[model samples]
Target chain A: MTGMVAAFTATILAAGSTTLLLAVASLVVATILGMGAAFAKLSGNRLLRTIASAYTFVVRGIPDLVVMLLIYYSLPALLNQWIDAMGIDARVEFPPIVAGIATLGLIFGAYMTETFKTALQNIPKGQIEAAIAYGLTRRRMFVCIILPQLIRLALPGFTNNWLVLAKATALVSLIGLQDVMFRAKGAAEATGMPFTFYLIAAGFYLFVTVFSLILLALLARRFEIGLRELAP
Target chain B: MNWDVIAENLPLYAEGAKLTLLLAVVSLALSFVLAVPLAFLRNGRVPAVRYAVLGYTLVFRGTPLLVQLFLVYFGLAQFELIRASVFWPWLSSPMVCVLLTFVLNTTAYSTEIFAGGLRHIPVGEIEAARAYGMSRRAQAFRILIPGMLTRSLPLYGNEMIMMLHATALASTVTLLETTGVARRITLNYYIQFEPYVTAAAIYLTLTFVLVSGFQLIQRRWAGYLESRIG
Candidate 1:
């Protein structure tokens, strides 16, 4: 019993950090995919737009749990088949963290694309015209006219996606990842103090959520001043 | 690729889908019933009642639904007092436990949405109601409830769709909903991946349908205010 208690206390903090790490990693991946997909959706090519929309459609439509399960359980066989065909001796299965981040990143990437695509399109037409008339390069125009307002406009949706993504990091526990949730479940099972451990896990999630809100608000405020200077 | 296995289990998947839909509907209906009054109470002039609802919403909204599910499903059984209490029979069943959790969780979220809508009711309108000597019940039903529900319909629709997605989590608690049967099918036929695909397809289809359903409902009830409502 004492040993179980010690293990529970030790894991609570360690797993908390891992969950944060997972959320951060997933956010980074989502950002990259979001930007790429957003550009694709904005492009003149019909095929590019179709593919981009399809990606977002399927991802946004499906539940996160189903995706997580599919990625974890279904991908290994395909990887093995490829490895065997290539004459490699090694076998491949995603580490639980790898699968968790990949699926979350993909799922949230679709949401980000929606945010980015709409924000990009909604930038005032006059701003771009002014930048072009000033003989600015495309890159310069984007930097001067598009990026600032885009960030300001996209901040609310971005913050929402991040909060949701953070909450979703809990599902990693279902796939056998030793995030705080998994550890809490184990402790609750062993110590027979489920209410305490699970409540603590909930507290951990709430703490991260509240802290992220503060950080994101400060970020939004930072960009908001630039927006005010531009438009106010 | 195992068409045989997937084909054989189509009925089972359908059953699982039915379970998922049933669970979501029951949870959503109960939560709505509980939330309307709670929303009214929270928006009332009483600070104490408002704060109590505030705390309830904060805790439920702050944490993940998955955590709440585990806590309610597993946590309640840990207490001898609860086990000895008359409510133990309901709490002991995973189905009821999950329903209880969903009702509480959705109540918190829906209350906020409803209250926000209520808050948007112009103060002038309330004063006008009072000036006309309208009773509180008359004012509530005729003015407040009608407008609030109309304005909040779109947002509440989104919440309902989210709750529908959350039914997927029922599998985590060992409930044999769509996702649960998906898990079982995957285990039973480790060589085949079609079951997972089928499950995803089912969820995606349901989401589109629900999204369209919400659109139709909004178009019907709040259609006249479409220029302002959505």
Candidate 2:
């Protein structure tokens, strides 16, 4: 029993850490892209709005699995074209990690664009006007006022997005990334007890999700403290 | 760019699309049937049953559907006990496995949606129904279910569309659905872009219909809920 427990713990740590790292990096990439796309979506320029809208619509409409597979299969060819265009002998391999991060980031960024856009809509228009009236520059207004409020308004949705993105990291295994699910699959096949190993994989996911929920709740509570005292 | 290639593959793609629609609609219908009862059970007085349903939903929702599909398809198939069991006949078909996974996954999601709607139902409504001498079962079916359905219809529609997108994962289990057929086309011609682009176009079209359909349902339910208030 002790030996089995040790083996399971080792497997969970081995897989869990890598998957969590990839997921966090992907979340960072997705957050940056999503902010840009959300801004473009809210821009007055019709062309920019249309382009951003199209990206979000198309990406969200398709399955993440399909997007991952397409990217995993096609990114090499796309990169090869760039390498060929540069007229260099240098060849770079797109590892499963790259594919996983890029694809997951790309898809989640589309979803986040909409989430952030909705949050942006909720901010009163007068706040921005008041900032401008106070002689604040556009950058200053965004940094000092708009950005903080936007982040707070979007935190709940963003937390949900982060949860979804974490679960999405499991799809990385489908593309041959040696994440927790991938390692679990290998162990399951080796051990011939598919249920046991898969249950362990599920347990790992539950642990991450529960831990994340607690952290999110704490962050949300911290954000609410002063606001609640001010409320009715 | 090549209309000719798309035209030639039209019928094949349509067949795949038809299969995709069939798989999604059938599974969604099954999911709704399963979810309504499960959602009610989750809210019932029985602690053990409620917790059991909660566990089932969590396990199904927390894990990736791809893993669950694989476990169902290959895991069960590999087992001699399952193979010898009478259930093997239903389990043998790829379509069956896909449908089972789709139904299970969507049921977990929809039960939560339904449960949310159920919670939002005012206690006053139940008290009013009780005052009218409605039986418990009558209150559940007539008042509670209708209120839940009206409140949940829009969210449930979104879940259905999400399930439609999820059906593409069925391709991973070797079911030759739309995406799978698209992959086969790409493999056969060594032309990757056109087939995938075509498949994506088809998916977007389906999503368009899904969104429109959900909007209509939302409008209908809005009228019903408003009428009840009136």
The model with the greatest TM-score is 1
Off by over 4 Å in 2: A1-13, A78-93, A125-140, B1-7, B77-80, B223-230
* lDDT (tens digit, per residue) of candidate 2 on A69-154: 67877556556667878998776567999988898899989878988999899888999989999999999999987887787788
Question: lDDT scores for all predictions?
Answer: 0.89, 0.83
Q: Give the runs in model 1 whose Cα sits over 4 Å from its true position.
A: A1-7, A81-90, A226-232, B122-134, B228-230
lDDT of 1 by residue, B49-142 (tens): 9999998988898899999999999998889999999999888899998888988989999999999999988899899999999999999998
Q: List the residue pairs that clash in candidate 2.
A: none
Q: Candidate 2, residues B1-230: lDDT per residue as tens digits?
A: 34577679889899889988999999999888999999898898999999999898877777777777777776676578999999999998888988998898899989988988898899999999999999999999988998888888877887887888888888877877789888888788766556777788888899898998778877776576767667
Report, to 2 decimal places, the DockQ of model 1: 0.73
Q: How well does chain A score by TM in each candidate?
A: 0.91, 0.91
All DockQ scores = 0.73, 0.48
Candidate 1 lDDT at A143 equals 82
